[model samples]
Target: MTVKPDWLRVKAPQLERIGNVKEILRDLALNTVCEEASCPNIGECFNAGTATFLIMGPACTRACPYCDIDFEKKPKPLDPTEPTRLAEAVHRLNLNHVVITSVNRDDLLDGGASQFMACIDAVNSVSPNTTIEVLIPDLCGNWNALELILQAAPEVLNHNTETVPRLYRRVRPQGNYDRTLELLQRTRQLSPSTYTKSGIMVGLGETDAEIRQVMQDLRTVDCDILTIGQYLQPSQKHLQVNEFVNPEQFADWKAFGEEIGFLQVVSSPLTRSSYHAETSQGINETLSTLKS
Candidate 1:
């Protein structure tokens, strides 16, 4: 394993606050992408009293090599009580913004879109003031299922184009680059008011130019927000780190993304799809200004 660079080191968060958040999740029997994916921002996000809920599973149907979430276990049926419990946790934590993501449940007919809708409705019922963001899977090109999720009217519709097209076969075997772009394109067309967001991870052997091209492709689809981060190997069995991109390079990428007209760009070693996600609220005001 390659040694992590100094810039990638994360500070420990206040455990008391993290513990409190964990207690709420455990009590509700909810799963979080933070814990399941081994996100580096877990302690920080949890300490700040927020989490990206992983509904429908801790196990995913597709075994992406870069992800840490388990793929060996079979996906189970959606729990009817899950949305309510997630809502309760949000209400208890008094979150102003919540990100709901899921492992790919390809086994389901709607690809778990209904479960996402149920979660959104449940959250809205208990915490009407809280804005919702869902980091969703590709739904296997099921546009009908995508429409179902859009009809639910989440504040932000996020689908990760996790890697560049060139590495799609190796890095994200089951993922299609064009399909990822189409999903974002469809989101913008279906709900012009809803913010469209995507994320990519660096250091898996992609060139700087390839990264920029991906950013441009995202802008072409009118993606409103972008997150670029460094990829860390979760275990020796997972994909090895190809390179450790420096912080300055990440800043350059942010600048390039903004130059290309992304409404918001978050680029850094630790930036995740949902990390500091609440900050995108500024985009609402920006878009409103543009329209006026």
Candidate 2:
């Protein structure tokens, strides 16, 4: 394992605020991707009074070697009360924006799409002013299931294209690169008003050219938002980091993404799918203003 660089070091967040957020999650019996996936920005985001709620599980159906979320061939049944509890957390946290993501539940026919919808509706019911973002799975290419998620109409729909095509089989064996692009394309076609977002993790032995090509491919599907971040190895069992991407490279990717017409490009060593996600609504306002 390679030593993490100084740039990758995260500053500790205010413990009081983080504890408050955790208390709410625990009290409500909810899960957050931040803790389940071992996200580095947990403290920062938590201290800022935000969390990316993990809905269906902390246990995933797929055991992707690169991810930290636990895998269970037969995970527990979906808790019908989860949506209501998650909505209560959003209301208590008084969040201006909320991101809801779920583990891959291939055991279910709908791929947990209905759960995503129920969560969306629940949040809207209690916190109508809050903007909703759902970072979803490809649903094993179930277009009809994807349609169910779209019907709920989240303000932003994100699906991470976790790695380059060349590394897909090794990094995301259950996932298809083309399917990711198709999902984004379908999102644009199905709900033109909603923003389509995707993310990529660097330091996975992918070439600079490969990263740029992924960005270009996302643009081809009219993905509106892009996030590029460094991939940190979760455990010794997981895939080791290939390299530490420098800040300058992240800046270059941001510039290239902007040049390719992405409405927003968040690239940094610490950038995650929902890192500072609330800011995205401003882009919608900006685009609307320009159109007006």
Candidate 3:
């Protein structure tokens, strides 16, 4: 028998300006993870007045079994005007905090880092008060590419570890676990003031011990923020959910993560990598004040 956890209950509220928001994005010819990735919290996020911007292109080079992103052999060229367009979208939406992510562009010599920086610059130009968060790819573990993004100086630099190292072969076949760790560590080394964040999806057959170890690995790399969420299958072709973790388990993990020295931890059924990004700034600010 399946049990629906209390935390999984989604309440749909009417978003007054959500249609205008959608029309603006449509007019700009931009795509969003909110639509592409089929995020379960879309309704809530939209109602709460926030959305994650998908930059670069819709085509990704890696074929992670758990992700539903299209694995395109050759994607279109980077749009030079995408920065301005995305900035306009943020302004139109009146976003206080914006989360920007992109498809992995291994085809580019710079691994799309320049494009990421451009988006950050564009957003900053228009929304000077808005906090910028970037969910970046590994750039194939190249520090030079990472440096370009660091120079832009987003408020948060997030690179998801995705899963435990043992599952990398099967789950993220083309992704290197060590490379991800190095990327997160290097981001901190490059900009210690920038809050470094990463996330993982549970219900992928990882044990409690393994999950704890993943937290330790993140801590060792000095990742300040962490998000743990349930792994819901996006499609039949994607990896199946091994188990739907209970809310109590998620609560226990959240407490464990805080005890492990993570400055902030978001672990819940509907939590995503970019969920509650606006509130996150306050959490990071609080932690920064404490550190000082």
Q: Rank the candidates by TM-score, best first.
A: 1, 2, 3
- Write down the TM-score for model 3: 0.93
Residue 224 in candidate 3, Cα distance off native in Å: 0.4
Backbone clash pairs for candidate 1 read none
Report the poorest 10 consecutive residues by lDDT, candidate 3: 282-291
What's each prediction's TM-score? 0.97, 0.96, 0.93
Quote the lDDT for 185 in model 1: 99
- Model 2 stretches astray by more than 4 angstroms: 280-292
Cα lDDT tens digits for candidate 1, 152-222? 88988999999889999999999999999999999999989889999999999999999999999999999
Instruction: State the lDDT at 126 in candidate 1.
Output: 95
lDDT, model 3: 0.86
The alpha-carbon lDDT assigned to residue 130 of candidate 1 equals 79
Q: Considering lDDT, where higher is better, how would the candidates rank from best to worst?
A: 2, 1, 3
lDDT of 2 by residue, 1-292 (tens): 7889999999989999999999999999999999999999999999999999998898899989989999954688989999999999999999878999999999999999999999999998998878888999999999999999999878889999999999999999999999999999999999998899999999999999999999999999999999999999999999999999999999999999999999889999999999999764447564334323
lDDT on C-alpha atoms for all candidate structures: 0.92, 0.93, 0.86
Better of 1 and 3 by lDDT: 1
